[model samples]
Target: MENPWLKINHSDYENHMIEVGQSQILNSLKKYCLDKYQPKNFALLGCATGNGLEHVKSNVTNKVYAIDINQEYLNKTQEKFENQIINLELLKRDIQNEELAIKNIDLFFVGLVLEYVDPKKTLNKIIETIGKNGILFIVIQKNKQTTFVSKTKYKSLETLSDISNDVNENEIDSFICLKNMELIKKEEIELTKSKSFITLEYRKKE
Candidate 1:
């Protein structure tokens, strides 16, 4: 696997997501995260180009582990937030690999990433990394569509057209509860009139 993600331009990806009302969705996520968890330390899985990063408040979140598999994306994040965040940690790791560690994280945000990894195994690994009383946030598409290319195309992301896979929302929800992760809150963000994504907040059971 070439990791089509590495070919994606972080700026273009963020811009496209913004056009799809991702900013609004991320804003709501941020509000819910801060009001509910108030985590001092957190991790943003697949934190590409720092989209939705504005929601991370300095006073509330002291340390952030901005993780992404692609080095270019991490590089952009470093450049964008180097001066803003006081204690920032950039981790380059693949979520599908067992070597990826998120141990003791107060909050974990997995946005638009489960589609690419083995959901159950990856979730298990991530849960183990979350400390007791920690929170995990996941964003999953309500509607399923694979093998589709973007309306706004970028030279780097052209290769992503070949990607095709299913991330069944129902299956994901089932796995979350099976792992003793309780669903605290769930909301659907209408990205478009017809397309939307559901955000599920799960807290560690013990």
Candidate 2:
């Protein structure tokens, strides 16, 4: 089955996310998560058009793997940051079913991508790929907005409404505890009148 992300154009997705205050969420993510633990090697899962790519300090976090399901999105990310990023790896994949090719990453960043996939499987895949004591920085919509669908019209994106899964915060916490991972940090960011995000930072059990 074709992924919904592959159906949406990067420009359209970016515009919609910005319109719905996704950039603000990214700002907080960079502030608390990216800037604090500047990992030497990291992967940005669901990195559509590579938002928050600027937070990586070349001298500190030089190696970055940008992974997404859509080829067009990865292409645009390459065009945008191929010069600034020293070791940029662009991976096109469906992470739910595929093992991450790169291993021992210091940080794994996922931005609102879990809602589209089976979170447990995706989380397991990520956990296996990250090194012991590696960080998993994640953000998910805390509450249902007017709808999961973009208020603005876009055929490819609007279809996301059908497949969108609700992320249960309590269930997430339970899962982390069940896996014996430590919850290092967490925050809630209110982006817009109708939008908010619950961000979490977890350290894998060594």
Candidate 3:
């Protein structure tokens, strides 16, 4: 089976997301965080082509770290935001890896990326990489049992509870375990023209 995250084309997906207003999720995330902390540096875990970067406050944020596993995605993001002059750093990294070049992040954004990684360890790694009291804004697909095929494979809202049953289990509960984090705020949004839903999970250091 092919890895879905690796198969994503950042440029294409970013363009589509922007056109469809799917990128609004990033804007919402920024608003949710800026309301709480005055972060100087921001890290976007799955910063695909840096689509919604323009929404980030330039004066408050001096640097933005964009990390993705696909080199093509990183390259596309770098090229797209090359002239933004926001000190953007495009990094090609498998987020599952424990080692990272940067740490003590002020704000960490994980958007629609956790479902593809080992959720438990991924959350722990994210918490470990950020500073104390730092903010983590995550947006994950809620349902995974009823697969739907529009342009991608996803689950229906009805089965969300079943799939998330073991919130503590390792393999079957990728989405719900995220809620175990010390939540600061959370909201649910239904996608346009899809059977999928998004759960925005926000957290602060415990």
TM-score, one value per model? 0.88, 0.92, 0.73
How many clashes in candidate 2?
0
For residues 40-130, could you state the per-residue lDDT of candidate 1 as single tens digits?
Answer: 8888888888776766778888888898988998999999888888888999998787455557888988887776677787788788878
Model 2, stretches more than 4 Å misplaced? none
The lDDT values for all models are: 0.77, 0.82, 0.63
Report the Cα lDDT for residue 66, model 3: 87
What's the CA error at residue 80 for candidate 1, in Å?
Answer: 1.5
Cα lDDT of model 3 by residue, 82-196, tens digit: 7873688888888777455777788888876666667766777776677766777777654444443223232232232222321222232344334444555556676653434
Candidate 2 local lDDT, 1-206, one digit each (tens): 66677788888888887786676668567656667777888899988888888777888886999999889999999999998888999999988778787888889888888898898888878877788788888888866446766577545688897778879876887787677578987778876666678888888888
Number of backbone collisions per candidate? 0, 0, 0
The pairs that clash in candidate 1 are none
Q: Following a full C-alpha superposition, what root-mean-square deviation does model 3 have from the true structure? A: 5.9
TM-score for candidate 3, please give it: 0.73
By TM-score, highest first, what's the ranking? 2, 1, 3
- In angstroms, how far off is 198's CA in candidate 2? 0.7
